[model samples]
Target: MMKKLENFAIQDFQNDLINWYRNEKRDLPWRKNQDPYKIWVSEVMLQQTRVDTVIPYFNEFTTKFPTIQALANADEEEVLKAWEGLGYYSRVRNLHSAVKEVNECYGGIVPNDPNEISKLKGVGPYTKGAILSIAYNIPEPAVDGNVMRVMSRILSIWDDIAKVKTRNLFEEIIREIISQEYPSDFNQALMELGAIICTPTSPSCLLCPVREHCAAFHEGVQTELPVKSKKKKPVPLQMAAAVLYDENGQLYIHKRPPTGLLANLWEFPNCELKQELNKTHTEQLALFLKEEYDIEAALQPLIGTIQHIFSHRIWNLSIYFGEIKSMESEKLVQVDEETIKQYAFPVSHQKIYKMYKGEI
Candidate 1:
């Protein structure tokens, strides 16, 4: 069972937080309206992305697919194109799938019921709570990392926030003290506090409105209260990529497999180098091209290397420029710059393309 705060303390905390929020909240684009669709888009984009970076993408996305029907009717490729630089391609895919369901089953309206909304493809507990509370003013607790930090500090809860079970603990505490009359402002206030004041490191405790009730602050352990285990270091990987050109000066690129890292995106053909190759990088590229695509090529290394990092892997990429002597694979397409521009390439491959065009 969760520890209960005194009734008077809960009232005081709610009043101070809500009042501070009304006076100090930033004028964000999503805050301009309470449309569930717009709010849902913002929430999805904001995951694992900073607010400043999300603003332009959010603006572009909403403009392109302003309504649930607009998003549902859009081709998956177009949606992926709009989300090209976002890095997390799966989010857009799931969002697209969910929106199609909403359009078909719910008449293009985001479901307000908690159970119904949670059943959507990408809607988790936090997302369901955010939509229900912010869009419909339902008294649901939105416990994101920000909210978790704020609550953990305020109540001095030492549970590991990284563990899935701890989310319920925080959610229960939030449900106990949430402002029923103003659930939107209350949850946003908690998130805002964590973002601006109760930060991950060196929190601004002096400016905190709920400082009086913050047990961690009084106990002098605010920075360490919300315990999270450290993540393992990313595994390093060596990869060889080929920037193949044909007699007609067209570049060779192919789509990735439909469901994995960088799924369905266009990229220069590449292969993982398991260990240090006995041959030169250029020779390795030639052999890989012949073995994988049955294409013979004269290969030379580019002037520099391209290193791209993902969440769990670091790609130490060596790029090679090659002239294709003969073509064999039907899967590989040779296209000019105009045709290439029509396809969405992963950022790592885009770097190679930029180098090919002398842009970097």
Candidate 2:
């Protein structure tokens, strides 16, 4: 067990960290202002996503929905469309829901009170702490993966970062040592340090601003301090997706169910392959069209396969082109290419469309 930093050492650590951050922090769009709405969106978008990838998306999203009211008033489909290609549809969905709640309940203001803010949809501990500390300048702990990695090395904590109890302990440690005078800068500095210097492999300890204060460095075990267990492999799913068009050459698509994985996004009608030993995937898709939508179809040759990996599942999509021989159900809509672009489809199906058009 490592001893806690003494008062003087804590002061030195805070000063060094905040000063380095003020001088070296990346000029991200969200850093331009402390608007809680923008901070909230940026933080939500940044979850499990890279900084560079998020830059253009963040700029475009904020520009489209400039304020909480703007986002809350916008159609859910529109919001989802703006968030297309970002993947993780649930993040935006929850953000949209919470934005509406904020607009209705809080008069378009993001609550500064921890308890009040925590009540909002999808605002977890890290997000709650981040908004409070960074947006409101409250001295709360904002411990994400990066912060946890940095804290583990700095305090020589050997706890498995994968566990929630370990994360709680780190949060407690941050509360104890975080700079009250500059809580926003303090939290951002920690995140920035982990991102640039205290990386997952071959950390740049020599250039680290608080190198002298790092417990793992002093103990010569910086690389081994943050112990994380390996993640389980994503479960594989074999799917057959059909791109069916009517005689008018309008493509058929449907919206996903309201509340589940990939909820409310549009997609080429697809399903998980229950692989009957006797039938081909295309034959199965034809049966699905007949059963689900009551459509008789002339299934054509396989277009191709598209592979998409989610955090918990990998979809191997078998794409097939089909024509609607007859139709009865009103569950699907047929739209021309120009009209189809208005709807938001999952990344996998988007690829399927591009492949159908030979755009790849």
Candidate 3:
């Protein structure tokens, strides 16, 4: 059986957390109203992103696509452009698809039923709980990493947080302790506490509003409690990219396949460096261009290298300038800088553009 707080203790924890959140919560744009669409967008954008970093992007995205109908009606390229630098392109794509589903099936009203909301693309457990509790004041648990950390310290949960089972346990615990009267504030309070006070390292125990009720703080092991397994380091990859320009000075770019990592994003023609092929990076670029696009190029020297880190991989791209010698495939598009801006390129390719311009 899971450990349970006494009734009084649970009430005290809820009141302290909600009261502190009311007074101490940052004035974020998402918190300005309980619009489920805005909250959903903010939640999606905030995943694996810092609040400060997401603020401007959130503002731009909401301003550009203000409602579920608007976002649902937007072209995929336009949505990707709005989410260009946010990385994790799949999130926006999934959100875009899900929003369209809601628009069509639910008449643009965000589903308040957990079962219905959970069925939406990319609306996982954490996001489901967040929307239900915060937007609808439903007493569901939003057990994200921040909430897990806060709860682990609050109730002294020592389970490995990286495990799905532990996350489920925290969800159960929060369900038992969440404030029904102020479910929205209660859920936000746990996340806020984790963000500002009960941090992963050297948590601000002295400043915690619910410090008196924190089991880990009383035990003097707040930092040691919320155990999580270390993730494997990102695998390093060596890649060769061709910034091929046609006679008109228009750069050549292509869209990635419609699925998988960086899907549908534009990029300068690029390929992984094959060590077994015994070919230099430039030679590999030439072969890739010829084989993939049926075009040959006079590959030039490296302008510079660009490195972009993903969750599980690191791309070390060696960029080379080239002039298109011949063209056959109808897939590639040649565009000047201004025209290129209309298409959404991944950050790595964006850096290639800057290198092409001698800006970086």
Candidate 4:
């Protein structure tokens, strides 16, 4: 049985890595402060998101919900609106719930304990350890994908890093190698090294400061150490939506189903296309209302077609403002402060709403 590589000059590694980071580290908004709440939010938002992609959203979110208490008290729709277009709606939901827990249990301050933080919804071993170490300076090594790739190459671990047991083994290796003097810096250094230097596809060993210590580099397998399992293709779906409006200038949007894809977010009266778009999309949309909601309206095309891709499905939408005959909105879901504040929406609608919010 092969034991893990438990010995390395962790301090030396940390020092050299931080020195490199001083010059090469990307200037991220979250790195500016050591606030645990902000770090927690950034980490959660950054799950499977690129740093460049998350920057603007992170800035907007931090500006809107400045504190954990704000996030806790905010309507779910507001959270979802903020999170619109960002896939993994469940993360937003859990982040909201976890903020409530922070307000209730931790008294508005995100706790410094890893285990306590881990108990919150959506937080795992990585997030818990990251927040504890980075924001609170706890001695936990937060091993994420970047850290894992770096580790697999450094130690020449040829096992598939995709499996939970294999990942757990790597975490154990990190646990043993983490330094006492500067565990947070060491942990971040490993992650940064992995991200910028020891990338999965083609590593730049010449740029790596620790190439001498990297076993995979010595064995000419730096690019092949951290093997991953294959990913399945995302299922495609035929989804449609309409932006209904009347003479009063109020748009007639429906509330989504209370759970699942875009739960509780507002959308134009949308329908599932069981058959392909056989006729004019606008004509078919009017017929859909006549059949399902028992109402008719003069629908005109205004909002352009927009497509939003989630992790699993794709939404191909065609929006039009329908000028319906004078009738009260008995069928439309009444959006209220209580009901509107949960569930993320597609980014297109959110963008339109933001532009037209003052008018609406």
Number of the top-ranking candidate, with TM-score as the measure: 3
Off by over 4 Å in 4: 6-15, 276-287, 300-305, 318-321, 326-344, 348-360
Model 4 clash pairs? 75-341, 76-341, 76-342, 77-341, 77-342
TM-score of each: 0.96, 0.97, 0.97, 0.83
Per lDDT, what order, best first?
2, 3, 1, 4
RMSD of each: 1.5, 1.6, 1.3, 4.2
Model 4 lDDT, full chain set: 0.76
- Steric clash pairs (candidate 1): none
Model 3 per-residue lDDT tens digits across residues 1-360: 344565338877888889999999999999999999999999999888999989999999999999999999999989999999888889999999999999999999999999999999999999999999999999999999999898888777778999999999988888888898999999999999899988889999999999998888889999797899999999999999988888889888899999988999999888999789988888888888889999988888887888999889999999999899899997898888688888888888889889988899
Which regions of candidate 3 fall more than 4 Å away from where they truly are?
Answer: 6-8
**Residue-level lDDT tens digits of model 4 in 1-360:** 236555666566667777787678777899999999999999999888888888999999999999998899999868878888776778888999999999998899998876678889999988988888888878887878898888888888877777888878877887777767677677777877877888878889999988777888889988677888886666665555665555556565676776787676666677766566677666777778877677678776645656766556677766566666644446675343344445355675664454334332
Indicate whether candidate 1 or candidate 2 has the larger lDDT: 2
| Candidate 1: regions farther than 4 A off | 4-8
Q: Write model 1 residue lDDT over 1-360, tens digit each, in one string.
A: 345454338888999999999999999999999999999999999888899989999999999999999999999878888998887888888899999999999988999998899999989999999999999999999999999888888887888999999999889889989999999999999999989999999999999999998989999999887899889889998888989998889999988888899988889998887555676666776778888899988786565689999889999988788888997888798799788887888889999998888899
- Look at candidate 1 and tell me the lDDT of residue 256: 89
Candidate 4 global TM-score: 0.83
Error of 2 at 51 (Å): 0.6
What local distance difference test score does each model get?
A: 0.89, 0.91, 0.90, 0.76
The candidate, 3 or 4, that scores higher on lDDT is: 3
